[model samples]
Target: MTVSRTRRAWIAGLMLALAGGLTPARADEPVTVFAAASLKNALDEASAAWTQETAKTTRISYAGSNALAKQIEAGAPADLFVSADLAWMDYAEKNGTIRSETRVNLLRNAIVLVAPKGSTQKVALEPGVDLAKALAGGRLAMGNVEAVPAGKYGKAALEKLGAWDGVRTQVAQAENVRAALLLVARGEAPLGIVYATDAASEPGVEVVATFPEGSHPPIVYPAALTKESRNADAAAFLTYLRSPAARPFFERQGFGVIGTEKRS
Candidate 1:
């Protein structure tokens, strides 16, 4: 009787262990996402949705697209990377750091000139207005072209529009587009160049003019599976981001949802 009871207890313990092992371990796994700083609000919403839908959690790190791209090149343990421009994505793809087939252009945005609401510096937007004359009121604000994708686009547009040479000296550079927007919003700078989405993000900033389409190369956002991702859930979330449900969300946040019709 004693032997039989001991054997039964062992069997019950084994069954419990087997049940625990059969349960999904994704419950504790973290999906790490590296994305552009401008995508903070939109990606946060998407991350919440992914977690709720899959019972898995995501932790995101946001920064300038160039900076994040360099980090990935140096072997950052990121499961996913979302870049504000395709340059970084292309770099990673060519270097075998990201799954090239997983690359997708997820969104688009445009550069714009912004000023603080009710600013004494009257920024005029008439056709053929001289950019140097317009930016002469106070210091200009812009993102650092070395690290920021928006800044790179803005600089390219200024260069293409023949505005960079005159206004380059007046510019005060920020680390990212949102930072540039903040400077203009605080009235610390008379003019700033940033993404239309970044201008829209700040309540106190107003768009003065948009960089003409084709003034610079298209601003495309690309996302890809990173080399360090361990969880299939991260891959799954990337799939969700490409779905119809995410399209409306990106559009409402000022992204021109790419891969969707109507170019909205």
Candidate 2:
């Protein structure tokens, strides 16, 4: 039997969940979250806090927004989804994978160029900055520009700054922003483009420069409950993320709070 790509993706996600020790959720089971990889640190902290306060546990799976959205569409039993961009959230909404009425813009972020901690690279992100010359025959690490939000945003910024043509051939694409960040952090690539929050979370990498505002689409994180979720606490967990209780966790990681605020 030939497996369709969508079905294959669904199977893969199910396998991963089972491998991670997840079972069919019951009312007593933890809230399952499929979140963008960039949200790991902040979300982890916020969710832990929520657990401390409510005694309700959570199980979160992190990946690129595109991959997560596809997994959700493929029938992964995730209770909540937080996407790195509006497009992916829109994708999930359009496919009826999420409860559209529960959707809201949750956070904002910025992109930046980064280098390994010991590297002495300084860049001014502007028109004609000669990004290719700065690479000095090395690769520019980034997420898969075609399918990943970070890569698309990075590509747009580079194009806007007139640097895309110069460094087009030297690009090294990764599966996600964190993987791209690892390339630079491990000194595999002299430079990488990632979210400001990602750079902040990795001590091995240092920000070289921030992309100018308006260079790319505004970075927004939209979140919602999955359509199939039946966990009684899922809605509360989603609300907690927008509450004042969760704002500091996100802010400490350099993410801006912009969701409809909820009372603690």
Candidate 3:
């Protein structure tokens, strides 16, 4: 979609929501959200609509959701938490950081292969490419699989294809998704594995392929309100997250809509 039309759609949606009293909150007070870095672009755009529709500000902090979940588990101040997967959300909910009923699937994404700009080397999809040769000029970038959801998905998919142990020792891990993307963008790494949305941010990178959907458990995002939040605006923000105003932005970023509709 054209950037202008996307912007106009956002503005029109916000205006319509406000006129229809869909969102109602005070602008001076903001809801604080801890979100996965993979959502950086889409959420930034969607959050603006929530702000305008409700007259409430949303202050978002992006990072590996697992790290943020650990912080929240250790008492971080946040009105809401949006996790890249259910594991982290389950951790928070189990620890009493987030209300159980508030936890709901938001979106899903897939793992994709991307290489630096102007690189002609194409990654062969047979049992994973030979890392040392395929990424001959630089390290292949990926998030730390221990905690980054994108990395976890990548690893799981690789493991399913019987290539994990073979490539494990040759890996170059980054702190988070964005760092991995940067590795490829700056030519520090010849290729990187990040969410489809994360790769969309850099014209310097191009996706070579996507892991088959059946390769790993679906990559799903979940959001929830926390009991520690005293902000009255938090509920309004959560509601806006599931609205039509935010749906297309998720699609524009290549995220699958999370609902009863399954991929057929």
lDDT digits (tens) for residues 1-264 of candidate 1:
256988999788778866856323255788889999888878888778777877788889998888888898898878899999888888888888898767788888888898888765554443344777876657779889666888888878878777678778887988878888889988899789888877777888888878888788898898988865667777888888888867766777798877632222
Steric overlap count per candidate: 0, 0, 0
The candidate maximizing lDDT is: 2
lDDT of 1 at 29: 81
lDDT values for all models: 0.80, 0.93, 0.82
Ordered from best to worst lDDT, the candidate numbers read 2, 3, 1
How well does each candidate superpose onto the true structure, as a TM-score?
Answer: 0.84, 0.89, 0.85
Collision count of model 3 = 0
Positional deviation of 160 in candidate 1, in angstroms? 1.6
**Model 3, range 1-264, lDDT digits (tens) per residue?**
467988999899889877865553445877899999988888898898777776678889999988999888888889899999888888888888898877778898888888988888776655655655676656668899888888888888778877777677767888789989998888888778888888887888988878888888888898888867767778777777787778987888888878433222
**Candidate 2 or 3, higher lDDT?**
2
Candidate 1: segments with Cα more than 4 A from true spot: 1-26, 120-128, 260-264
The lDDT, on a scale of 0 to 1, for candidate 1 is 0.80
Question: What residue runs in model 3 are displaced by over 4 Å at the alpha carbon?
Answer: 1-27, 259-264
